[model samples]
Target: MLWTHKILWIATLVSAFAFLGMTVDSLHRMSASTHADQLSAQVIEGKRVWQHYDCNDCHTILGIGAYYAPDVTKSYSQRGAPWLRKFLENPAAMYPSGRQMPNFHLSSAQIDSLVAYLGWVSRIDTNGWPPSPEGVTPAEDAQRAAGGELAGSKIYLAQGCNACHTIQGSGGTIAPDLTHVGSRRNKSWILAQINDPRRINAQSVMPSFAQLPESAKQQLVDYLDSLK
Candidate 1:
């Protein structure tokens, strides 16, 4: 009985020490992994703003904070500076529907700093963390909210269309919002725009999707068309 008790104590102590060592090692590597050297004055100020406004109460960063809002660690990379600027300028216009983000009334300078801080945060080597489930199924839940997944929707996301266009109350705002594009444009017109934006507008910066397989392009057109 004494020997058995001794073995249990040893196992418990070994497990506890191993956990402590891991925690320490993770802390030691945090600075290097997060690129502490890249934290600029603007980024530091942005962090101050984040704390001052208590953003963590709603949003999460680095997978830490509340679940009330979305994680913003990769927002800068996914949405880009242009998108973030417009959204910060007016949260309602960017997203007016359900589970809205409260306007923080952020100043231009503050907005700039926040974007910079988020950009820096996006670069942190999280080592494939958070297991980006959205990439695998872009229209998984969100698209279902709109109306079950469309094959074309997958292509649309794969082509990064959301980066420049807003649809279903989400995505970027650099270009036209495609939330109701079906009402404004016909399927043929949509296909033409995708095939070659320059053909419609000489100065259009949208790249052509003509390189995509014909079937895939058709599916994307269908997805865009279904938005109405």
Candidate 2:
């Protein structure tokens, strides 16, 4: 009985030590993985802003919070600063249809701070979490290679145009709907818009995507021009 008790005590100690060691190792690595040293003062304020409005109640970040809205963990990287700024400024204008994020009427400073904070959050190493559950392929780099998806459509998706423009009843509504844009605008006009939106409309809030490869620009233009 005494020896059995001693064995149990030794096993418990070993297991406890193993758990403690692993916890310590994880904590040590977390700082590097999350880039904690980059947590700037603006970022902290952004976090405060996020909490001040209870954004978690409607959206999820880092896979924590309600699932009612889209996960914003990677939204910063996916949407880009310009798009985010536009959307944050007017959530209703961005998504006129479907579930709408209320117009918080947040001040410009607040919006900038929140954007900066989200930027930091997006940089954290999440080890490829929040996988695309609706997609056919699990591989990140696997571009609909086997599917019959259009090359132009693929380019549009890759460029994140859906962040502002609605196409075929899908995508964001912040910008003009492209469901029938082909019928309204010519190919040259579409190309110009892609290269520099401000050229067409001085008041256009849309950012220029002139940096995209020439081939990609043509492909994207083809996709947008075919939305008839």
Candidate 3:
């Protein structure tokens, strides 16, 4: 009975020491601020909005949350503020692919705050957590540098095409995979569809790109055409 008690005490002490060591290591690692002084008043408000909306329910930030949606940790870096604002304003219009991101119908002020919060979140060092930019290709980079197709690629990103469409194994799967759309559709048909998707398919949900600059539209067409 005495030996048994001694064994139990030793086991409890070992567990306690292990737990303490882990806690101390975690604290030491966290000594440097992940967010630091980047959180401003606007950022704080934005975070409040994010929490109030429970965005973490659908999207993961800093590797925390449900895996149903994309990680938003580096959204500011990937999409930029303009695209983010537009997306926040009308998520359905941005990507009619199929994964429905309900429109929150946020006010301009709320949108600003949300973007600010995301911007701040983007500044945190996660030690290369996400690891790479999504949907980007070496060929696309080369085309972009050459200035025609790349310009269209920029327009695609600016317009938030990835929200609905997947490209080269990246982006959402709500809509048709556009990895090789160029091979399936000609430039004229693609342009016509972008200008008025309803002309081709009565049930198409794609919004018109007629408002975009002609150059941007043409560049986008060229980019899509080059996808083959």
Q: Evaluated with lDDT, which candidate comes out highest? A: 3
lDDT of 2: 0.81
TM-score of each: 0.58, 0.68, 0.62
Candidate numbers, best lDDT first, in rank order: 3, 2, 1
Q: What global local distance difference test value does model 3 have?
A: 0.83
lDDT of 2 by residue, 167-206 (tens): 8788877788888888899889999988888897998867
RMSD of 1: 9.3
- Residue by residue across 128-158, what tens digits does model 1's lDDT show? 9668565446546565636534567756765
Q: How many residue pairs clash (N, CA or C atoms closer than 3 angstroms) in each of the candidate models, in the order given?
A: 1, 1, 4
Ranking by TM-score: 2, 3, 1
- Candidate 3: regions farther than 4 A off: 1-33, 133-159, 162-222, 225-228
**Range of the 10 consecutive residues with the lowest summed lDDT in candidate 3:** 29-38
Q: In candidate 3, how many Å is residue 27 off?
A: 5.4
